[model samples]
Target: MKRKWKFFIGGLVVVAALGYLGYQGFIASAAYQYELGEYLAQPGIDASQNVQVAGQVATGSIEQKSFDLKFTMTDGVNNMVVVYQGTVPDSFRAGGEVVVAGRRDPASGVFEATQVMPKCASKYVAE
Candidate 1:
């Protein structure tokens, strides 16, 4: 009877630990997606809030610095400089589609990226 009780308690603890870890991970990785046009049009977006915005990198806008990277992302009509402090993706370059996840500073008007996800076309066009 004592052995059964100990096993039951241990199993319950392991399940609870797993559940808590999953919940924390979900919270930390939550992001909202917005197209470049839609995000630029919204004037009411709060700078303090985290968001994920997708756009193509503007030509001749990439500049690498010692500690950070800077570039302009545009939807053709409007563009904003993004400051990223993470390793850039190999597929990321000028004219490539990318999704940046982070918060924007109201004062600087620069998007501070936590993660930069580069997108590529799955299928190539036939010549």
Candidate 2:
């Protein structure tokens, strides 16, 4: 009876530890999504926190050099410069909608993007 109780207690401890680790991992991996204006309006935003900002690509703002890309994203009222080093998506273009994920540089106020996802237009047509 004592042995069984000890084993059960050990199992419970293991389960509790696993649950705690899982929760921490989820919190660390989660990125907050924000609109361009909303994000820019926040006071003292944490530069180290990973975030996703959605905005429209500003016309005549895109500058590409091989794999490096730089552009300005706008929410009509606010604008932010985003620098990304990766393959540009085919759907990405001036005036197109895009979601950029990464951390913001505190010194230069530029968003250093790890991923750039362009919003694709709907292919379906209604009669």
Candidate 3:
């Protein structure tokens, strides 16, 4: 009787601990996806939250202001301006597909990108 009670309590504690760890893992890693239109519509997005926005850079819209790079990204009708301070990838050219991860300053309406990755097309090769 006593042994059974002890085992049941121990199992319950282990399950609770595992559940807490899983919740912690989810909270520690925060990621959000935004389409260009949805992102533009939300003009008040918190700048401190890490986010990923998918879009294409508008052609002839890239401008560099000192260390900060600015450009207009578009998804058909909607357009949003983005800014980043770091070095850009060699393949990051105008009208190219890219996934940008960073924070958006609501005050300035500029996206400060911490990381930018280009999406390249996969070519098939005959073996």
Clashes of each: 0, 0, 0
| Candidate 2 collision pairs | none
How does candidate 1 fare on TM-score? Answer: 0.73
Give per-residue CA lDDT, model 2, range 28-125, as digits (tens).
77899999999999957788788999999999999999999999999898999999999998989999999999999988999999999999885767
The C-alpha TM-scores of every prediction are: 0.73, 0.85, 0.68
- Checking candidate 1 for backbone clashes, the offending pairs are none
Give Cα-based local distance difference scores for all models: 0.89, 0.94, 0.83
Q: What clash count does candidate 1 reach?
A: 0
Q: Which ten contiguous residues of candidate 2 have the minimum total lDDT?
A: 118-127
Give residue 23's lDDT in candidate 1 (0 to 100). Answer: 100
Model 3 Cα displacement at 110 (Å)? 1.1
- Rank candidates, TM-score, best first: 2, 1, 3
Candidate 1 weakest ten by summed lDDT: 40-49
User: lDDT by residue for model 1 over 1-127, one digit each (tens)?
Assistant: 9999999999999999999999988876677799988987887987766789999999999998765899999999989899998678789899999999998888888899998999987789999
Which lDDT tens digits does candidate 3 get at residues 1-127?
Answer: 9999999999999999999999988865686988878877886776777889999989999998666788888887987788788788788889988788888877777787888787785675789
The clash tally of candidate 2 reads 0
